[model samples]
Target: MSDTTQPPFSVLFVDDEEISRNHFARAIRADYRVHVAQGADEAIDVLARHGAEIAVLVTDFRMPGRDGDDLLRQVAHEYPQIVRILVTAYADKDMLLQTVNTGDVFRILEKPLRADKVREALQLAIARYAERETRQQRLLAMSETLGFLAHELNTPLAAISLFARSVENDVAADYDPERQKDIGAAARAMLNNAQFCLTLLSSFWATVHKSGGQQSVAEAGGREVRATRLIASLLDTYPFAGAQRDWIEVDVQGDFVVRTMPNCVALVLSSLLSNALRALADVDAPSLRLEVVDGSEPEIRMRDNGGGIAPEIRARLLQDPVTTHAGNGGHGMGMIFCNRIMQSFGGRLGIESTPGEGTTVTMSFPGPRNRL
Candidate 1:
């Protein structure tokens, strides 16, 4: 909560003027670890020595040799996670726009920087830096998990699949002719489990690491992916593929395409499929259907015949991390991630259901461009 409690987070202040630097550092040094630079060159040296320790970079523009713009540009390229703020006396609309567009600078303060205003901006910048650190930590954890999954999960999967088939063959030879089908069915379930494990292992990593960067930033005009194709593919080969896989069906009413970051959609669908399978466990005549409606507003719908959401669960389903499977270690991040994905693409994820009846989850994007 306070810098005194933990290791101080360092903030670099770059200004040619000694008076300004000294005055500004005194304002916020109590809250943050301060590192002052006389000019752009010294700032570079300081950054090189303490880049890992430095969280915030506040530099004054219009320096003697190289300006704040140059320093911020270097920070953007080298330490992209660092929070960059530019302090300037002069203003050029184009310069500011370019710096902001390239994400080189987070905030711009006028030359006569007040302690109060600078402190406020620094606080926000530090918060941003903290968030970036958190994201990097998550990415690191996910990478470690994925790195080990190939050995830890796949090895056990091989044993299960092989042993299940061997048992089926051995048991079938000594069993009644009518019971042969039962042995085969049990063996098939085990094989399905193996397949599910494989799919999850591949899909989870692929979905999370789409562009293969520390942060996967989805570009506009991504390769067009069809809604029906994704659904059909998942239905046939998904983690939830089991006896209920036969009941899951896909229907494409007309031509429809999701033209942006389809991996996000795939990840969301995987989460939903897992939930649907869990809900259908206690229901009789379980069924899951995927339907894509093609028109002005193309929509992908997932309808599942399972025990529906409770009144309280339905109320705050997307609003918060509220899961019915709390006892089973469900954190409710899956649905939250799904909602945010739709929101990112100017779309809406709507859910409707009755207590006993099924649930229908609809995904409506900001319609496809051009006529088919």
Candidate 2:
């Protein structure tokens, strides 16, 4: 007898033949929560009602009106979290392989399906769904934790900045000319660093609030602004010490406009500037240039004459949060965050580097009319 207790997740099985649907459901109903449908249309109806509860979708390939492939495509777009499995006969194996290659199907079961094989496929699909859910939860938790930390640091950082400015003013009034210059420089450095920290905290808080911890950066509200003007504002507000400010050059081929959340863009540019400075810490005559290119697809490029990245490290930088400066407290999420923001705006971020030569990071945005 099949077990009567409800399982953690449910499965939806669709087939044109009533016997096939019933047999498939009966074979695994005891171990799983099963819903049966006669055709693609009925299966879609079931999904509309119980999509959240359903973890796996098992459908036969040869239905009368709409085939399993068509149903799979629709499900893949609408209910992407559901793991999909296709049931087909041996004659349809070649075509089914193509669907699997396209990532529409997870596992395929042969017709005249054996009870044992059906149970095994359900086990694997359920496991996959559980893993995905767990990963998403972890990411949300991490984001919340970072947001809390940023909130807590804001108060003390603002106090420090206030004290630094006071000290600069006092030094200017009381100290001898030579001594005043030295003390004022130190005080200004402290002020600049504090202000930079404040800027980052503000940007992060805005992002968390706008996204509500779930939505993409594109969904965050924004206004259209010229790329060159934005870059100029960022440079003016950035905390650059000593000769570092002189090392940067801005070139405007022609200004281009894009619609994006300004605070998010500030956060990205600040991170990039920090990384570029760190890379040039030991280099001779280091230079960093910002270029705004005007065309159908606008682009903002940051070129730095620092120690360029190696092939293997550069490949993984955008894909994963892997950092080379792990020893120096680099969590490696800067580029990953930047890439995500660009993608959310229907834009792209690319990096070109030749070791010992230089590295150029290009941000390509949609043309004016396409700006979101």
Candidate 3:
């Protein structure tokens, strides 16, 4: 809402005592759209009806049926984004801390609350609520953008890949060996490009779905992924590695089965592959190898024989947004994001590198003690 029309971000002042509740609302109503509730039950009703409009909630600790903690706890669980302030006369610091920690109460004020102190607390609470709203709006906008890009690009990509594959198959069946080699190479190129687009689309879809608050679909939290298929798919679909497809090698000792989300794997590996490709760009006879270990750990190791990172940079490699491409549009949060995803999957994301030697990023998921 516009600034002029928007009633100063709303606040709900709740107290069982009539004088305190009326004073609280009166002191704040000049600067804020204040709503007053007599007890916990009325507070609940007010929240249910005007939760979206109310930015901050200031409640007395000693209410009739339920205390402010109970109301704050319910608010924290159901409407976590709302800012909560507890007004109390209780001298228990530990209890206040607990309520702050678990119930998500933003501020605590003693019973003899001054108008200035209460306003200060409400200001902080309002700021926090505004911050949360801005963050959610940004996420929603970005998710919409991702959804749009994924939808637009996927259609054309699907059509091209379908047509290209059909042509490749017809050429393979009709062409002779001599001319077939060159045509086969061309066909492979098209197929690889198509695969790369498809892989990226998977990540785009996952991101869009996640940001849109619909992350429970595939529930990639469980481990039931086809290890080899996921690996092979990532290898074929990754654009950076695919551009230099011949430079990268895959060495699978045996069939390694691991539990992880295929899309998660794709996204994590895609980030690693991208970094490897960029590192191997200017190296003489560069090579990026994908090794799936089967011994003590089932690990997917991406080893690149490119220029390694310097000691200073290596120290905070994945911990920070340390990037070699600062001038470009890269935000350098790729590794950070990848590392988080790995951790969420109960996997270890490790990295080793030497200047001028190379870099190897290993992603190992939790498995049986013997290792799959």
The candidate that achieves the highest TM-score relative to the unseen native structure: 2
**Candidate 3 global CA lDDT score:** 0.72
lDDT winner, 2 or 3:
2
After superposition, candidate 2 runs with Cα above 4 Å error? 1-41, 44-192, 204-223, 368-372
| Ranking of models by lDDT | 2, 1, 3
Error (Å) of candidate 3 at residue 344 is 27
Q: Give the TM-scores of the predictions, in the order they appear.
A: 0.50, 0.51, 0.49
Off by over 4 Å in 1: 1-194, 205-210, 213-223, 239-242, 326-331, 368-372
Model 3: residues >4 Å from true position, as ranges? 1-6, 90-94, 173-372
Better of 1 and 3 by TM-score: 1
Per-residue lDDT for 242-272 in model 1, tens only?
4777777788797577664466566567667
Candidate 3 lDDT over residue span 233-290, tens digit each: 7765565534488888888876566543446566667767767877888988989898
Candidate 1 — worst ten consecutive residues by lDDT sum? 213-222
- Name the 10 consecutive residues with the lowest summed lDDT in model 2: 147-156
Question: Against the true structure, what is every candidate's RMSD?
Answer: 11.4, 14.4, 14.1
lDDT of candidate 1?
Answer: 0.73
What's the C-alpha lDDT at position 10 in model 1? Answer: 85
